[model samples]
Target: MKRLAGVGVGWRRQLAHTLDTMEGLGFVEVLAEHLDARGPLPEPLVRLRERGVPVVLHAVSLGLGSAEPPSPERLTWLARLAERLDAVCVSEHLAFVRAGGVESGHLLPLQRGEDALEVLAENVRAAEAALPVPLALENVASLFEWPQPSFSEARLLSGVLERTGAWVLLDVANLYANGLNLGTDTRAVLEAVPRERLAYVHVAGGVKHGGLYHDTHAHPVSTGALMLLEELVARLGPVPALLERDDAFPPPDVLVAELDAMRVALARGVARREAA
Candidate 1:
């Protein structure tokens, strides 16, 4: 697969105009659940396609890491949307949002036990079988970690990629948040993940609430997260990264400037890599 260079943003209705006018955006990812696979694509998104920007379909409801099999209907919708948009790929969390028929209402981290790994591997294969394009698994940030897990987060993610032959959508902010909360080395997390399998990277903002840095994506990108992103680019050589701002929409100019900052960091990393 071609490495995605430059910065992208998660396509939001509120930022449509900003995204449309922005220069040098490498790609955008649209939330799959917001779209109807049977209907015509959103006009703005269609325009992006017309402008030659790659779109990736991102899903939150698949609950792929659940003990149960992935929802067939959700997978079908993702497949249809991907085919319709000619997306670069389809991605979902390596998390389970529901269990025993109960919805968690938020993405929940999975236990890194052997059983969980096997279950996740099976679900990933099931998803890949149904997806028209490649399925990439994203690592999520959590306030808590499973006790006495059989593998580290890096090992579990790499195992899933190995078992299913899928892609890794490494979220740098999530890695930083996890490090802050769990007290692990965030840089080690970045280094340990299988860089060759990385599909892209995600950068988002968060706030320190009650002593924990939340990966809320509702604030500006923190300095530490940007630094981690630079480290990732230094290791992987300028993989595609999208700034994810889900709420607290900033002014268009501010968002553009944030992207510009990321672009500069990415360029520095690539230049250093090339020089080395």
Candidate 2:
């Protein structure tokens, strides 16, 4: 894949029009929950292929960061999508969303420890084996952090990556949201993530309730998230960066403009780096 510029719209409803706008605006379009194997990708994805737009797969329920192994059913679906789309990368949350001996509805937070590491490793390994593209693990904007005997967040995450040999889809906005909500120092969290290991950035907006933040990804990037994103792009260099807006969706013009702003900011940064 060629170098991806600043922003991408999270593929949501009205996808045809969204792709049309994104194409006109030079924005990459990230594929949505089409990770399911029911049949082929959602019809909107075909429009992207016709337009020759760059596409990446961002999964919501891989449950990689959970305590369960990647289920055979999920693996079958992912393999189908991966082979069909020729995706740049496939990604899921670092937190487990499914629990139960069957199907858990909640996106569960894992206790940061050795046992958790084994769970993450096995899941990632199974996913990597099936999908030809790079397998990516995303940082969850967790509402709670479990008390662990030892292994800090960085240590646990780094250990999983080291053993599994996969990449990280760093969600900078989630990092900030966690800090804003849970009082977890976002910078310390970012440092724990190996700078060189990041494959892309998911930039999005969120809301605050009392002391907690929800990863709504349904608005323009927050002022604080924007600042942190700038630092990330500058330090990490030009990687595929995507904007996720999943609710209270806006008209295409407004969404495209917001993404364009992010694109310009990132381009200026890349230009400045070259001059320096």
Candidate 3:
């Protein structure tokens, strides 16, 4: 698979015009659920595909970490969407949102253990088998973790990657939240991820609410997250870095400024690596 490179943005209808006019964008991700498997893709998305921009299919409801396997229909739709858009890859989170026929309405942390790992590994394998392109699993920001898991966060992810041969969508903001909430070193988490298995990286914004950091994605990227990203770049050189903003859309200039900031941070890290 070709390595995802440079900086990117999540393609949203709110920012479609902004992204459409922007120059030098690396790629853009669209929600798989929002797209139809049939033809007649979204106009802006079609324009982006026409411009030779790589589009990644990101799924929220796959719930790969759940006990149940992802819906066959959903997987088939994702596969069709990837083929329809010529997507570079399809990605989902490591957390589960549903169980026992009930939806959590949010991505919940997985109970780390043999059973959970096996279930997740099975789901990932299923998705990988269905996707025409590669499948990438992302680490979510956890509000709480299960006690004394069989594997560390990195170990669990690495094991899944080893078992399924899937790549990682390492989210720096999520790592920062997890580190802050769990009191673990974020850099250690970064180090544990296999650099070669990284499909891309995610940087987003969040806020501290009720004494806990939330990966809300509605705010600007935090300093701590950007620092972690810089450290990651120092270790892995420059990989594809995608900025995600889910809601509370900002002005086009502010969004562009954030991308510019990431570009500057990545450039500095690349320069430092070359100097070393």
Candidate 4:
């Protein structure tokens, strides 16, 4: 598998022109559901590929953490997209989007227990077998967690990696939100993730609404999330990080500033590691 390096941004139609001419752009992640395998490739994306930039395919509806095995048709879509783009890897959330023939339209948290772990592992293995490239599971932020579980978030993630041999896509923003909303020990969870298996990092913006932090990609990246990202970089050493903006698109300069802030955080992390 090819290792992703430097800073990146999620590729959206709104940012196509900016991305096309943006300087020092390392790579871009595209939502897999937004594309059609049989259709013509987006011209800008093709241009990026021509420029030797890596494209990663990220899926949101795989429902890998569901009790049921991943849908074969969804797996096929992911596989075909990866092949179409020669993607560096395919990423999905560690949450279920649907259950019992009903769509939740949200990434619902999983129960942190032996049974849930087993089901997740089985689904992940199915996804791994179907994907053309390496699979990376991302930890999601949820408003509420199950009553009691046998495992912590880090332990559950470790269990999944051990069982499926998949990579980790650490989302710093999600971690920050989870910590704020669910009283999670953010630093402990960060320290527990296996550094060697980390594929990349996700940083996004969110807001505190109704006394809870919501991981909304529409806002500006928060200071707390940036700090968490720096901490992760300090531990892992120059891992690839990407800024994700899904809606309420900001101007190009603002987007560039966010990426710049991320780079600054990365630099701070490197300095801290060196000092240590």
TM-score of each: 0.96, 0.87, 0.96, 0.98
Q: Which one wins by TM-score: 1 or 2? A: 1
Question: For candidate 3, lDDT tens digit of each residue in 76-190?
Answer: 8899998988989998999998999999999888888988898899999998998899999999998898888876787777778778889999999999999999875676678
Q: Sort the candidates on TM-score, descending order.
A: 4, 3, 1, 2
**Model 4 segments more than 4 A misplaced:** none
Kindly list the per-residue Cα lDDT of model 2 for residues 1-276, writing each as its tens digit.
334444566676554566654554334445545445556566766677667666667777678866657777777776677667766767777877766665566566677778777878988898888877777788877777787436565666678878886888778788788777667666665666665667677888888777677778776677777666666656656766777776777777787777776777677656665766
How large an RMSD does model 1 have?
Answer: 1.3
Tell me the tens digit of each residue's lDDT in model 1 across 176-213: 89999987667666876677778888989999999999
Give the clash count for each candidate: 0, 2, 0, 0
> Cα lDDT of model 4 overall?
0.93
Task: Write down the TM-score for model 2.
Answer: 0.87
As for candidate 3, its clashing pairs are none
lDDT by residue (tens digit), candidate 4, 75-164: 998899999999999999999999899999999999999989999999999999999899999999999999987878988887898898
Model 4 TM-score relative to the real fold = 0.98
lDDT score, candidate 1: 0.87
Best by lDDT: 4
As for lDDT, the candidate ahead, 2 or 4, is 4
All candidates: CA RMSD (Å) = 1.3, 2.7, 1.2, 0.8
